[model samples]
Target: MKQRHEVLFKQLESYRSYVLSVMENVTEEEAEIIPFGFKNNIRWNLGHMYLDQYLWIQAVTKEKCGVPEQFKSWFGFGTTPANFNSETPSLEELKNLLKEQPAKIKDVYGERLEEEFPPTEMGMHTIEQVLIRTIFHEGMHLQAILDLKKCIQPSF
Candidate 1:
């Protein structure tokens, strides 16, 4: 892997660790609360962050990345906790998936960061570009998780 790609993966791991740290003390009940003025809960943000990477990467590669089929309905853009069924993954399950994801992505795509594909509507044409976009997306959701945490535990 290139030095730049290694740096990118390190950044990815660091940000994901920050996200998981913010979530460490949250209980499942806390995760489910969609507090006033928020469209989703911490749980939805977590699930969405996990699913969005796969969706964007698959879009760029034109290949599936093993994201669970139900994730689309549960965590896709515009999806809300209201739409989630019993089939929706629990907070622990989602956390486990999120915890493993960075390493999995590194193992799977570390060498192909510069491989270009046809540009999507967003003009992303390389694995590195897609990873950058997903990192930003994760940060956005990380903010959401923080906000939800504040709302769920005023003392937080």
Candidate 2:
């Protein structure tokens, strides 16, 4: 079980690195530029990744999330661009949050595997299940960021 957790942890770390690398060269304007017909911007996508991960991992695990209330609704499962009006954190802030996530997740996993995770409208999930979904969700957005980058700054 520990070995499985380690593997999942490493996979999450790799995906985190991939996300950071994609955002490294993106300008502020580029981050906010929504591709035509797309509902959310890159900034929203990045923020959503952090918010959702924190919600599932920390909130569900009965750990301290420290998420600002103002940003909470932006991350709700059914939120769309039409309903999400908050500004995104700066690129530096987003990167810092990403940097902190792996350690936080490891610490939480170390302390609380036996406890039940919180229920959601999407239904119940084990800790491992939540982590897997979070990883997949991040990958989806990372691909979206790539697509947006290609559209906004083709020279890169």
Candidate 3:
């Protein structure tokens, strides 16, 4: 399982870069624009991924949740993009956070993959297990973001 997770962490970095590549060259307005049928925009998707990754990673491991406190209000699950305000991180900031976060995860938990879960609801036993779950979560959001881009801006 550890070996699988080690490879997964690397794959997470690659998937994150792909997500960022799909998001490049979008203006703030473009990032913020809610497509005709979508509930969230590109910016919100990026922020939510950052926030969710922090939350899930922390749930399965003992490490500190890395993002700012206000992330819960703006980017937590069930929060809407419509609520994105001045306090929301900028496009460049979000991009930077997303870029470095997977590497940070590897740094903190790479060798610690067998750590027991912290009474989490997911019934996961080890940190690597939850990290595996996160890979799928991020991939789902990546597709959602790409769908949003197709509605608002093509891949660039």
Candidate 4:
């Protein structure tokens, strides 16, 4: 892998580690709490984090996304906890997926980061560029998670 790819993957891993660390103490019930003024809970944000990367990568690579079909309906953009069913993944499940995802992504795409795609509206034409965008998106959801955490655990 190129030095830049190594740095990008390290950034991805570090960000995911920070997210997991923040969520490590959250109980399942806490994860499910949709605090006032928030459309979704920490659980939804986590699932959205898992789903968004796959969706964006699919868009750039034109490969079929590997996540289950229900992911789109339950965790895709514009989705909320109201859309969840009994079949929705538990927080533990989502966390496990999130924990493993950076490694999985590196394994799959590490060598392909420089591969060019048609430019997105944002002019992102490489897998590396797409990964950068996803990292920013993850930060956005991380903020949402922190906000929900503070609401659910005022002392947190």
Q: Candidate 4, TM-score vs. the true structure?
A: 0.97
Residue pairs with backbone atoms closer than 3 Å in model 1 (clashes): none
Q: How well is each residue in 32-136 modelled by candidate 4, as lDDT tens digits? A: 998779899999999999999998888888888689989999999899889999999999999999999999999988999999898777788888988999999
Ordered by TM-score, highest first, the candidates read: 1, 4, 3, 2
State the displacement of the C-alpha of residue 74, model 1, in Å, after optimal TM-score superposition: 0.3
Model 2 residue runs over 4 Å out of place are: 62-64, 78-88, 117-123
- Per-candidate RMSD, Å: 0.7, 2.8, 2.1, 0.9
Q: For candidate 3, write residues 1-156 as lDDT tens digits.
A: 367776888788888989899877788888888878888888888988888877877776656776787898888888887677788898889999999998888887788778666667878767677777877888888888878778776633
What are the per-residue Cα lDDT tens digits for candidate 2 across 1-156? 477788888899998988998888887778778788687777778878888887876545666677786566664566654555536466677778887887787785755544575675565446777788899989988888788888889886
Worst 10 residues of 4 by lDDT: 118-127
Instruction: Find the candidate with the highest TM-score and give its number.
Output: 1
Q: In order, what lDDT does every prediction score?
A: 0.93, 0.75, 0.81, 0.93
Instruction: For model 4, name the residue pairs that clash.
Output: none
In candidate 4, clashing pairs total 0
lDDT of 1 by residue, 46-89 (tens): 99999999999999999889998889999998899998999999
Write down the TM-score of every candidate.
Answer: 0.98, 0.82, 0.90, 0.97
How many clashes in candidate 3? 0
* Candidate 4: RMSD to truth: 0.9
Q: Candidate 2's error at 46, in angstroms? A: 0.4
CA lDDT for candidate 1 = 0.93
